[model samples]
Target: MDWAEVGTLVALLAAGALLSGFLAGLLGIGGGAVTVPVLFQVLTTLDVAAETRMQIAIGTSLALIIPTSIRSLRAHLAKGAVDTVLLRQWIVTVPLGAMLGGAVANLLPSDVLEAIFAAIALVLGLRMLIGKLPFLLGRDLPGRVGRTVAGLVIGGLSAIMGIGGGVLNNTFMTLYGRTMHQAVATSAGVGVLIAVPGVVPFVVGGWGRPDLPPFSLGNVSLAALAILIPLSMPTVKLGATLAHRLTRRQLEIGFGLFLLTVSVRFIASAL
Candidate 1:
């Protein structure tokens, strides 16, 4: 690669690392929101083909998330928020869900994947807006059934979309009575479900895809993960510590705005 290309790649890595670290704590999300968009945009400018762009973007994004989630999970665990029992259940299902989801995504055409992503973006955007209401905060709906069903939907979506599932898990857990801290902590566990099985098919399905990027494991790209994971680890702790200091609404407002921006971008990309 030329120096110019090297410089741009480094810039992207730096930006991705910083954004993932910052938002991981601020939004209680896993950072795919930022990484995928940035990678997509940057890779496109580099003349990467669309055929493998989304796959690598999603794969590399999730790759960073593996470490990011662990770091973030550690912070939340320190604050006494992670629910071990609930996390156990996800362990059983997430792998299967992620693997299946990746396989499905591989089989589908670009338009289908794009459509699904667009739909998810709008729903997430609406969720971000609606979840901010006073009624939505700390609201308790009593039932294990509801939580279980929620787990299914969230996990399935996570694998299919190649996200860590933190946003959905955080939102649902909060709606089901988990405090903000608990929700964030618990959501960290959601990445395991996504990263493991999801990655399997991402690689298997994208084996021979035209114009695939360098050092890719299936559809998942390695270019960004090499830099992102190491940086995000310690920074996640930073975000978690900061979360304790920020007011709940302050965090929510920031998170909501972040989601809104990402949603708009995804929708536009799909269109």
Candidate 2:
């Protein structure tokens, strides 16, 4: 790539990492909600094939999520906001679902994936904005089997959308009568689960592919990972701090708006 191109890419990625890191810390998200779409836009300017673009985007997003989730998890831990028992219950099924999701994503087309991501984001955003999306099953988090089902759904969808499981987990936890702080904190643990086993299927699925972008391994972009991880890691603490300061309603509104914006971007891409 030329110097000008390199400069632009650096600027774009740096900005994205900064915002995403903060969001990850604050919302217990993996930052892939922002990173996946942003990275896809960046890759479009390069030589990657359209067929593989979404795969690479999702894989790379999952890879980048690893460190971000770790840092976010620690921050939430320090605040004593996490629900440990819930996290433990979700650990196994979440990753299993993530692996399955990665495998399934490889079978879908790019536009289809984009559309799915956009639709989910839009629904979530509206629900958050409405401030009361009901969970009719109960006012308490479910039993082991119910949790396993929730974990599977959250993990699978997150893997397909290249996100941390935070969004769904946070909403689920809060709907089940947990405080938002507890929900957000536990969601970070969900990110840990999703990102760990989640990354493997992506790599394996894209192994031996010939048309991948430069500095790629399977579907993961080494270049993107190198830039994003470092840039995002340090900022997570800052976001965590801010998260604690914000009121529950404020956090929900902010997260809702962010999802709406991301939904629009993904929809635009699909079109």
Candidate 3:
């Protein structure tokens, strides 16, 4: 690419990293929600094959989550808002689910992945937008079997969608009567769980593929990772700080609107 194009790509990556880092802290989402879409656009600009673009984007997003999630988790932990017990229980099941999701993502078409991303975002968006409906399943989280199931689903779906499991975990916790702050904080921990193991399957799946972009390690783009990781890290604490300042209702509305916008964009692309 020309210097102008290179400059543009760098600029875009920089902006995306900053925004994502802030979101990671602000929403406990590990910033994959922003990273995936931004990486996809970057890959497109580089003329990456359509068949591999989404996979690469997702894989790269997961890799980016590793440090950012850790950073975000720590920030939340300091606030004593994280549900450590819940995180402990999900340790094994969530990783296992993430692995399964990465494996499944390898087999699915890009459009199908997009659809899955869009559909899940749509549901979560509506749930948040509706603002404390009386449809909660219970006043407390479910038993072991149910919690295990929830963990698996959260890990798998987050892996597939290139998220940190924040949105899903946050939604799950809030529905079960946990406070939004607790849900958000716990979701940061979940991101670490999903991202670390989640990256392996994607790398293995894309190994030796001929159509990948430059500087790629399997489906994970080292170039993107390099740019995103550092630029994103510093902003995470800032977002986490802001999260503490916002009211639960405000956070809910903001998250809901963000997800809805994302869902619409992807749904249009998928169609």
Candidate 4:
């Protein structure tokens, strides 16, 4: 990349990292919804092939989310919000699902991935906009079989969408009568599981692809991961602080709007 282009990419990545970090703290999301779209645009500017750009974006987003999710997880853990029992139950299945999801994503067309992301984002957006689900599944979380099934679904979808499992996991938990705080905290753990194992398949899948940018491994862009990880680290703490201060209702509305915006952007890109 030219010096000017490098400078521009760094600036954009910094901005994206900052925003994503804050969101990660505030909402317990891995912030991939925001980062993926921006990275896709940036990668396009670098003339990355259409076939690989979306995969790179998703991989890089998941990679960057590792540190962000860990930080958020720690923050919530301190506050006694995370659900250890639930996390234990999901540990095995979630990673398996994530790996499978990444493998699946490697085979799919970029347009299809974009459409899937858009649809998932729309669901999350509407949930946020409404502030609460209109219905409840039950008063308590499901049993082993149910959780395993949920874990697979969450892990798979999270890998495909390049998200930490926060958004969906939180929604699921809340629907089962868990508080938002607990759901968000636990979702941070979910993000770790998704991002960690999820990175491998993508890297393997994209290995030796001619269209990838420099310092890339498979579909994961090392340059973007480098830029996003450190920059996002501190901001996650700031976001978590802010999260603790906000009313649940306020957080819901903000997250909902954010999802709507990102989903619409992805949909537009696909068209």
Specify the highest-lDDT model's number: 3
Candidate 1 weakest lDDT stretch, 10 residues: 133-142
Per-prediction count of colliding residue pairs? 2, 0, 0, 2
Stretches > 4 Å off in candidate 4? 1-6
Whole-model lDDT per candidate:
0.71, 0.86, 0.90, 0.89
The order by descending TM-score is 4, 3, 2, 1
Best TM-score among the predictions, by candidate number: 4
lDDT for 250 in candidate 1 is 58
Q: How far is candidate 1 from the true structure (C-alpha RMSD, Å)?
A: 2.6
Q: Candidate 1, residues 1-271: lDDT per residue as tens digits?
A: 6899878877887777887876676556777777876777777777887776776777677677777777777777778778888888667666666676777777776657666765786677667666643555445744566556666677667766767887787777776666777777777777755776677777777787667877776777776677777776767777888777776565565656766776677677776
lDDT of 2 by residue, 1-271 (tens): 8999989988998988998898899888998988887888888888679888888999999998888989899988988889999888877899999999988988898789878888988987887787756554467998888888999999999999899988788778877888878888888889989988888887888889888887888989999988898999889998888888976566678778988998998777666
- For TM-score, candidate 2 versus 4, the one ahead is 4
Model 4: worst 10 consecutive residues (lDDT sum): 242-251
Ranked by lDDT, top first: 3, 4, 2, 1
TM per candidate: 0.87, 0.94, 0.94, 0.95
Q: CA shift at 96, candidate 1, in angstroms? A: 2.6
What lDDT tens digits, residue by residue, belong to model 4 across residues 116-168? 88899899889788877778999999988889999999999999999997888
Winner on lDDT (2 vs 4): 4
Measured with C-alpha atoms, the lDDT of residue 244 in candidate 3 is 92
